[model samples]
Target: MNAMTTLTYFFPRRVLRAVVVLLSCVCLAASAAESEAAEQPNIIFILADDLGYGDLSCYGQKNFKTPNLDRMAKEGMRFTQHYAGCTVCAPSRACLLSGQHTGHVHQRANGPIEFRPDPQDISIGRLLKNAGYHTAMIGKSGLACNSQNGNHPAEKGFDHFFGYISHGAAHRYYPQVLWRDGEKVQYPDNHGKEGKHYSTDMFVADAKEYIKEHKDGPFFLHLSLQAPHADLNVPAKWRDPFVGKFKEKPHTKDSHYRNETHPKATFAGMVTNLDDAVGQILDELKEQGIDENTIVMFASDNGPMSEGGWDRNFFNSGGPLKGGKRDMYEGGVRVPMIAWQPGKIAAGETSDHVSAFWDFVPTACEAAGIKPPADTDGLSYLPTLYGKGEQPEHDYLYWEFHERGGKQAVRQGDWKAVRLDFQTDPSRPLELYNLADDLAETKNVAAEHPEIVARMREIMRKAHVDTELFKIPAN
Candidate 1:
């Protein structure tokens, strides 16, 4: 051996050996951490209640500006052909979480009142939890009303939940008590009138806390904000700006809930407040150093509401789409959706890749490297998100409503077919609209295209399996 090598061999050989082993272990630990981080990404899905397709400035809302949402669109991918599950709340949320269409989803309508997802049901939360991720739902979880009755968010795979359980309770922004996990936590300050405590404020705080707590996380967060819905009430600070801007019509008071004298201003304020929440969530992700590895999504539950003195036509909330909530039109189902990831999803992109609430399940599964349940109607849009591979197209998309004389709609390629009053009269003539030609859905060309109408009718018939609660009446 050389003179230096012989000197090193004589100088603490056991100490040198231990030092080399320690270095190897340190490198291995770092490699394991990097691998875990790469395998799992944080997911944040923010669902706005009763927000219309054109409610955001980015989506063409001219009356009020939504700067944050517009910025989000500029920083992310905006979806022009994205749709909500249904025209209502509970069913729409169910479709989103369960990854099932209205036909197959458990909650078909707003009521069989106090509807909750079955314990054994396959939900996005459960799927993610099974894949070893922390899951939480904050804000208006209209899925289950009474936690004591047992169909709580906890049962549906959320480790933590804080929000209004009942759909009706959600209508009132300030409530006496809200559900926290499995218990009802009282907010005595929030009485009948506008109190110091605001549900939206609470939700935002909770969401931020959750993110901070799970920063070193593979976490799934569903931030369901009850904004711009009905009972058009907002905090004075948010509502003050829009007051007296638009031509006024005082909203007549209702017994069920408080009414706003300046409904127009209040509505705009509520939406802007929601926009602020979105901005805050994005900021939190960035601050937590997880923005690059997190996929942030924003979407509405359904179309704008016509109730609580809110005017859909005045604001052009549906944009060029025909009809509002409850109608089987583009306005009711089609809503703005934005997906943001710094490097993963291409920035300043727009995707017309037709997708809906059900599609989210497979998309989330693909992102998390988890296998989605076999029975899901959803197909993953991860390819579109990643902007890499070929994205598979859906044969058709379908939706059915139990209320409003019963309505069903199907979209096959560029053609849309609607069967209105289906339960009342199963033989009613179908309305066919070539969405490619008429985005407004003004003209019905059933007489011009009999063959397409027939195919649409058949698809509607097969799309839905007979459910006792949402059944086609026997004539």
Candidate 2:
């Protein structure tokens, strides 16, 4: 007090009073900044594997109902023009987490062989984790290069990882073994027609536990669910709801994966089961009293698969869009996306926002008040999510698929250009469609609009940067 009074006496009375006020304001600002930092929300991104664009009732499915997903749409924002990273699994997930599109992303296909992400890769997990969010990746990690050598999810910036590292291994719904942070967990019961443990069930259980434990603060959970993909295997209890709902037909084909006795029932059952999983996660958040503060997003890795004895036509899985998986068409790349955040995102809203998986990394970073990597191609839709600030729109979105005779597609405004059979000849002309006029992509009006088509062709060539690993061959 003696020293403070002596120093205060040196200053004039008016100046002394102003200095005291300034000191108080500085203390208050520091406290406010701390409070804001502590309030960063938990972000949960639940990605479904091969669940079609029309799988959910809210997204125009007629045969089956995904009530939980529909409820998510009601509680959140449903994106109509949202697209997956790519047309298939590995590349799509790669494009997603890396915040890079197929053209610039490391992995570009489900592939000639299984691919894994690099340890140094700039992914959503890495970005959010650096921003102080406890990151965990649960369920199918289709981006792994192989079982062992490739960078594990932990190395790729996730604190914890549980599920199959290989996309190929994930095809077996009843996998004999699943990975938990590089350790293999055996499920001996997962051997025969009736496996003791279903992968989805285990995944959901772990997800609930993780949420309950981390309910306090910031966390990034990537729940990449491997449901409704193939094998068409759902527990009898879940399968019972959809039995006899559609025509009974045994799917016995010598395919890559196991065939189902009742493909349609099991297919619908799988989707409904996935819906239940989503509901469970939502319930857990509410129970933890973190519902409003948590940002829960749901989307599929890609569109519906026609393999594994699963019939896309029976389900009309693609909805009104053309083509299914393995193509660059809307059905293959476009997917259903729902973002739910109570007291944050507007309720009962539908956004025709043209967004993709690449946008997720930047979005999460921005929401957490962290700067995204400069090299990323993603644009944060945080403005759109919160309905505040300015939302930056993309001039174009690009994708290239290696399999199914090699395909490439680009979207600029309303014009969508797709070039197929390009592996043999990269110079092939693109099939053009104005998505604004023809959402089905049935009519190719390239002749009428040669200028747009030429621009698109240039974009297709310029957007892609050639890499030895993911090469677009020049014939």
Q: Of the candidates shown, which would achieve the greatest lDDT relative to the real structure?
A: 1
lDDT digits (tens) for residues 1-475 of candidate 1: 9865786787787777787799999999999867865779999999998899989999889988998888888999999999999998888988898898988887788854433454546688889998878999998884643324433788778898998777777888888878887887888888744777888889999999999999888999999998888878889989999988998788775776576788888888999999999999999889989999899999998987788788898899988888888888999999999999998898899999999999999999988887888889999998999987889999999999998789999999999999888777878899999999999998999999999998998888788888667777532
The Cα local distance difference test for each model comes to 0.87, 0.85
lDDT of 2 at 289: 97
Q: Pull out the clashing pairs in model 2.
A: 115-144, 115-145, 116-144, 116-145
Relative to the true structure, candidate 1 reaches a TM of: 0.91
- Cα misplacement distance, residue 163 of candidate 1 (Å): 0.6
lDDT of 2 at 212: 88
For residues 175-249, write the lDDT of model 2, one tens digit per residue. 897888778888887873458888888899999999989888789999988888877788998888788877877
TM of each candidate vs. truth = 0.91, 0.91
